[model samples]
Target chain A: MSTPKKILVHVDGTERSITAAQYAICLASFYHADLTALYVINTRAMEDLLKARIFLKDEQMEYEHDMEADAERYLNYVDELAVKKGLSITKKSSRGSVHKEIIDLVKADDIDLLVIGELSRIRSRRDEFYDEAERAMRTVPCSVLVVKDEDKVWEMYESLV
Target chain B: MSLIDLVVEDIVKIPMTSNDKPDVLRELVQTLKDAGQIDDFDAVLQAVQEREDKLSTGLENGIAVPHGKTAAVTRLKLAIGIAPNGIDFDAMDKNPSKLFFLLVAPPDQSGPHVEALAEIAKLGQSRAFCKALVNADDAKEVVDLMKGE
Candidate 1:
């Protein structure tokens, strides 16, 4: 296989996912590759939250606004990091199941590499969400890099922290 | 290192009053400094802020693991803090953060660092475990819960 020219990073705004983004940015910088950072919102979870909003309609709106603001903050952070590192990057935000969104983005953007944070190695059948993400990995067309907690790459980011 | 390698003591504060991410981090860093677990509190704060400039540490389920690897630390350590008021760590869930696991590791240990992060991610995803952390009133309670007691 040839070297990947573009990378798609899956960031959930979690510490782990953000860390994964950091790594992707660094790699992009090294390879002089283009990067697309994506945030996937679980629509099902949002629907559930909306369904439970019996007592406070305003509160739910406030909650959603807050979430969007947070996502923006995180995306901006990544943008700044890329700028500082001299890496080219594009950011995208979507609301849907994480796996499907990631797959779609891969096909739409011609992404050569897909990066994601590892959830857990030990998951029961009850961990349906992670199970779905893991299953999606099998069908993804590009090279996949799962940033596990046990990987040494985190130390590189840790140094900058 | 395993998440089990990290220990929580009497530092967990249930019902923390701060509702913002900066304030929560401020409080937690201060607590660690006061407890003498860390020296040069300002350095740690700067490191965290610099890291936050790159990305948020907020995870799912109202948990934020704000961490940094710094030269000020001699070894890897973990501090657990709980805020019942749910500080905004800018979690992906858009939910306010109630539990914080502040990680500090030396700049040299590369492999253990990632393992430590992975361990935290594993623990953070466990709803039951996070609930136990939110309910913890003191450091020992937090430690015991992380220990799966």
Candidate 2:
């Protein structure tokens, strides 16, 4: 029954991310806690270039730029959703490994709880690149909520509306 | 509500090659036709394009659910295609999509169409699902993985 202060929600502009955002917003509203939505850009394109994939260099740059722009557009949507729900929310974007950035933010912001979608790539029980959230859960000094893919929240929404 | 609502068969290709969005989409639609899932390829493509013009179905995690509810389709169906190399989809993430869940629902079933899109979005958000999709070698594997097997 400790008071909640700040909560961080990781969003990757995926539908699962949106659902996670929706749930986070609800939690923020209930606790009157500040919500921060984050999007992480994968640096694998740069890694691909370093691997000597010469033909992909230009395409890789274009892809990176597009991803940044797309992240901005999606953050705008999250911002709007926060406004509509009367939740105090801020959105931030970063580049690099998703788990590292998320962990850094948790410590820097002193986050009370971290919420993210539990899916295939990010839910690795083991593995460096894929099981980012699981890795963070073990190391970070905060509670983690991995939203299930088949959670009944949407079903409830559909039924209520 | 038969499980085989969509007959992808040999039409599903992995590591599909396409320089851009239109070409990839056209190829996927043609695959559906070749698999005998749809009667008219051109009409279905047009419908999908027109829908894209209105709103992108890219939900996240390098995934795009480019769907069309068209009269060209007699039944509700879905076709999944994986582009391991990723295709430019003008998605919100600007990441070329390695996974696509192309849905073709009857124009009349608006509710299910939206539901399907949401469901696909939910599936894409799961990092595990996206990883499996990127690694899947063929259509049957893709279908089986999507069905949670």
Predicted candidate 1 versus true structure: per-residue lDDT over B64-91, tens digit per residue: 8777668887766676778866777887
Name the 10 consecutive residues with the lowest summed lDDT in model 2 chain B. B1-10
Error of 2 at A50 (Å): 5.2
Say which docking band candidate 2 falls in: incorrect
Q: Candidate 2 — which residues are off by over 4 angstroms? A: A49-55, A121-139, A149-161, B1-149
Going through the candidates in order, their DockQ values are 0.04, 0.05
DockQ of 2: 0.05
Clash pairs (backbone) in predicted model 2: A14-B60, A70-B92, A119-B126, A119-B128, A120-B127, A120-B128, A120-B129, A121-B127, A121-B128
Q: Worst 10-residue stretch by lDDT in candidate 1 chain A? A: A47-56
Question: What's the TM-score of candidate 1 when only chain A is evaluated?
Answer: 0.81
Candidate 2 lDDT, tens digit per residue, A5-104?
8999887655566777777777787778999998776554244322322113443454456557657876787787777766568889898766788899
Comparing only chain B with the true structure, the TM-scores of all models are 0.89, 0.87
Q: Could you give candidate 1's per-residue lDDT for residues A51-123 as a string of tens digits?
A: 4321134434443454466557777888887776666689898866557888899999999999876755443
